[model samples]
Target: MDDDEVILSTPEEISAMAEAVKENLLPTKSRRLYEKSYEKFMSWRSEYKTTSFSENVLLAYFNSLIGTLKPSSMWVEYSKLKSMLNIHHRTDISQYAKLIAFLKRKSEGYKAKKAHTFSPDDLQKFIDNAPDYTYLLSKVAVILGIMGACRRQELHMLKIDHILDADNTLVVNIMNTKNRIDRTFTITGKYYKLVKKYMNLRPNTCTSQNFFVRYISGKCVAQNIGINAFGQMGKTMAAYLNLPNPELYTGHCFRRTSATLLVDAGGNIMDLKRHGGWKSTAVAEGYVDNSIQNKKKVSNLLMNSIEKTQPHNATTTYIPETELVPVIPAPESHQKNITPTLLPSETEPTQTPLLSQIQQDSDIPINTAASRNGNITPTPLPSDTETAQTPSLSQIIQQNSDIRINTAASRNGQTITISHNTIHNLHLHFHK
Candidate 1:
């Protein structure tokens, strides 16, 4: 009813409103991060009086950050800002190839530092040495985190109702995973009993529905475990086991530890992917590549193969007995026994005819696989032409090449040979 208020009912206005909503296109969890990233760029742009964005601006911005931040952080900020800029300003910077190359050039020799993982022996020490009354919560968290390959958020979001007890095992369901893929894992043996003990200790008057609860002194408390507390379970176990660099053991150490242990136990990359709920083969193979047991196994296998090596057998081919009837050698100019049934070679003219271009002669009998099963019905040379001049052995094969020219005496041992460049239609049936 108020005429002063603007009405946005036109198609163009509606489209503008649609584009305006894209400012929140980033993931719900990372919107705050995107905002912070975008704010940094906006502040820089304001200081330099750069009103518009371009590949040049992004390149300069990253170049300025080169000395101030770690190479990895520069990339992180680039990605966050790229996504935010696309959504808020409708600028697509992903097609900036040169800018990407510059980032890659700057990132040379920059290796990411991985989180430290404790071994099964270390975990065993924690289980046996740490008192159950004081570290029951830590025990349960560590076991579930490592066994299930759980992220910190997954553990934090786990509710009491998600756990199912079926006879001897306790089945735990993971619903809110990073990939949105649901996973179910079960605890058995002592792990199952340990989880059951913790479940019994959970306060009946607890207000939270989360499976993990805060424990003080010797008893469980009413408060639920925070994400940071879930993450600290790694440090707690590491410190208890007297492992070095306890501070480097973070929430992801459990996931990495699970993959490494499985690979050490003879599991393949596929097994790592399936057990850890990883979708990328590269991510799964990284664990295998870093495993010491796998490396030792591969080295031993290579050395064993070398030690067991034997001399290779001479190469031979199965020549149809009917074809290439062993040409017996004579003390004369050529072999006395001439197998006219064999395809005769033409006279050595001034030019060597390209054998590849030569078509099958009607006079030549089919001396291939088809002839092998039956008798060879060789056609005689044209009556007008005298006995065709036989091509020398060197002409048929290369100089110094291995040649086992079998004669009537060696017919039992078939030999195969070929010429260089092209073998023509001489599809000689060969076998070892």
Candidate 2:
């Protein structure tokens, strides 16, 4: 070693080198904490700092030989030390190489699997049973995503005016989209009317010009309803519906479901891509693949094949009724025993003779039972004087017909007797 080549051995020289590393901390949280670690190293170096000491001396200081900073803390400290000395200073710190490698090895251990996408049935249940607000949000999200294949962020930026056309067709301007391209999506009959209603009723104001404005303090504002808000709403909706764990389907699932269902419904893949502003056909193709797989699964469950066993059991087991069951009619063969009956009100003669007056005054002429439902043959009425004298005479003529009157009681034996009226009493025959 040449005399001109300076060797860093003095306590002050070693302390200054460590302090330089701490002062030049990188831009990240825990930078202050890591700087303290460097300061501690420098303080200890005053008593033991030396250029001749092997890499073991540096490891002892880093591992905190005086204290127990195991596994997690040790890795944090090791990373900062290595980053500052090796990366920043570009120093050949060979001693700490093994420690750095050891920490990285542990970090590469098994990471938890990410949550899976929503199944078709599960998604349907979640949407169908979601709370009012959440249901509306989910519906709009699905329709927009499926029709236009909208991203979560794109949906956040959607304005009411984006949906165009007087007809059912919707035209979404893609300037706010991820790809910055315009596209139009056709709304189906089920969703078109609702989307139209929502657009017309959306909050409007001067301060917030966004289509979906938030109502704050009874004033409409252009504050963005976060993408996370939609996700959180979904979670709340899932809980309300009592769905399975991880019931909350994220916004991305809406996009996936839309693509899958559309293709399954015989939508043109090329057209779907164009309207969705997709740069390539990969995503569209994936939708088709997933659809086919789902179709196969459903078909396997529904189809009854003589060659194959049933998906469910063939035996029908009856479950005992735990609650009261109301008796319902069975499809057994029987005749209904019915008899002609009349209410007392219907059979009894009215004291006021209201029925007789009603019959005489009615435009529809009443007929006897023998003539009912048949063409009536009218008989001429008796002379006016005879008819006028017979108010109660109609009732007697309807029952007893052999009414005799001695003409001697009137004048001489001239016998002036005549029938005045005729009435048919349906009840009289029943009584007899």
Candidate 3:
């Protein structure tokens, strides 16, 4: 087969060579599963008495499973079938655009079940209450899983020798990982004590090199814990802590819990991504979005914005539930026969009605604060001025349109004083 030396002897091609090619194409771990998926397709062909294998045949086969399987499950089935057929049937299901669209359309509105992430308080409860001797292995695994944010496979492949003792602290090195990248973390303080105690208790008779061991009763019995056992660590801890639906806490819970707690504590998402070895920013920030503290922080921010009162100055005041003011200046003196022309514009409006004007248009005498060419100004009250106990008419004017107010009475009187207190943007004048 090497060097292409010759195409001699009629160039023989073996029928059984297809099986060898299929085996080589499949992943070693999932080889059995790949074979099973292909065998299922073969069985269906036999049952239907249709030996033909084409896009149409696959379409019909998949259509038969539409109502029977969830879209997500069908996707898994598609992956397995695609892998096997790519080698044997020479069909690249990935190139089937129509089939991809069909599955995508079918998956619309499908809300996937999310794994539960436990709170740090619940984790603390388990750590404090769970007996160390009875759960020595689990105790170490759960803490390491969360603190280091280790995946289940990473935990499974962890070796006893991989944990190095450095200046009274234990440094855990994950030699084997799902991403094939090495990650190291330190276990110090009380956490170091737990690991140290477990290490001291390891049976010398064990041959396996894995760090976590199979424990029965209160002691470690073997080395190299199974992957499934590593995965069940979350579920086991959840059940022991009396959490509802312990099964919902999958193996990824420790990883999620680690990211969530870090996010809730105001840790940077980029740092969390590096901490958990997540390459995707969306994945890292999703933990932040789900954090109870993060959501609470957003809620408070929105509320404070809506409920905001006034400015930063000491004199600034807020509107009450009912309209009110802190102070209202009292009128200086009461007067009569004084048609107060609100503004100093020499001539009053003939169309608008004053007290005298309403009855009949008459020449009304006004005050002498300002001449026809000058500006009008009202005196502002001091801080000691008494405030209104209830809402003032100024509030009604504030809510309603600005209107000119005029009054006249037929009697000898004094100058009528206008108070600028409690009223915003209001000025009135009198002519003598």
Candidate 4:
């Protein structure tokens, strides 16, 4: 080959290039989905027998499917068609802005219903009632599904060689999962014993290497179980148990129930992600949220306390029932001879006997004046005594405004004075 001349590729080189391109193609399962979607679309629009795909035709087809299919299902079909077109014609229908916008707007506010989960009790009941060999298989399946948190596909792919016994625990090797990543889990407790027993009873005549096999007509059949078979098993068990809404339970229920149970048992999100083989935290979080005890756990954390303390006592003391009853009326005869005392008029400044300075100084009796209507008034102080000029009531109040008094009145431009003895009494009364 000359430097200036371009060399033509050899047949081997072209073949190698073709092989490399083929290596980039979708997996077998994914290709099947694209093929199924394309065939369905073509069949629906058979009248338009064009060899090529058109954006208008796809839009019209998807629009017609709006009411017939759920948003999620319709979106799946759209995705498959998009992938098919891209692979074959090197055209991406999803690149059309209008189609993308339309699908996005339509899918908004759409939620898919989650599969129902079976309680541990219901699963145990199904296991107990399962007939003989079937019981062995069913018990193992339930154990693997619940304890290993295996998906139906993962469970189907399990082989007898994948399970290993290590002292007290059984290890399961999972392969070809939804995320195409392989993982292993160690299971222990009662589930480990059940798996061991199942292994012991597993038929020797079984031809298939798959751990879970069918027992029909009293014979162990070696057949690779499909995903649907797992779902059917769930339905069968539910029906046998006479459970309500048996249709709600499916193979996926095992995975969901396991995740929920782990979350309820206080398994952390990161640990749950690893146990469930989830590729994203969002998926793990969703399982945690769906747990029946999710909100209950939150409430317990927020409201419950472990420590106990004394309860608060009421501010008021409890009164006895007898104290609540009224006292008997005093005899009417005793009230007839009682004499009424006469209170002095406001104009009378009557002088009362004042004891000697020593006696008066020792104990000053502050006499409160009673009105003609029997209302008590401020005590009138003896007109400024020689030994001690009594402090005016106003001055006393100003000096100790913190003390509470009923009432005080002024008359004839004279302010009543309360003696020191009165002040001391007032202090004691307020304190009491």
Scored by lDDT, the top model is 1
RMSD of candidate 2 to the truth, in angstroms, is 24.6
In terms of lDDT, the poorest run of 10 residues in model 1 is: 356-365
Q: Please, what are the lDDT tens digits per residue for candidate 2 over residues 289-365?
A: 34556678668766745435633434443334432222222111111221112222332222123223323332112
TM-score between candidate 3 and the true structure: 0.64
lDDT of 3 by residue, 173-261 (tens): 87656655677888888888888888887899988888878877767786567889877888988889888999998887888788888
- How many pairs collide in each candidate, listed in order? 0, 0, 7, 0
Cα displacement (angstroms), candidate 3, residue 85, comes to: 2.4
> TM per model?
0.67, 0.38, 0.64, 0.61
Q: What is the lDDT of residue 420 in candidate 4?
A: 44
List the candidate numbers ranked by TM-score, top first. 1, 3, 4, 2
Model 2 is weakest, by summed lDDT over 10 consecutive residues, at 330-339
Give the C-alpha miss distance for residue 153 in model 2, angstroms.
0.7
RMSD of each: 14.6, 24.6, 12.0, 16.2
lDDT of 1 by residue, 185-251 (tens): 9999998998899999888899788988888777898987779987788888888877888988988
Candidate 4, run of 10 with poorest lDDT: 355-364
Q: Tell me, by TM-score, which candidate is best.
A: 1
Error of 2 at 418 (Å): 91
Order of candidates by lDDT, top first?
Answer: 1, 3, 4, 2
Per-residue lDDT tens digits for candidate 4, residues 1-432, read: 212223554466665675468446866667677777777877877866765466777777889888888888887887777776775556788777778777888999987777677776787777666675555666677778888788888888898899889998998898878887678888798778767766665677777788877755445555666768887766777787888988877778788888888877878888898888888998777765355567777777666563233243433343344323222222333223323222334542432222122113222223234332333334433433222134433334435533222112222223333344444444443344
Better of 2 and 3 by TM-score: 3
Clashing pairs in 3: 327-387, 337-409, 366-431, 366-432, 367-430, 367-431, 367-432
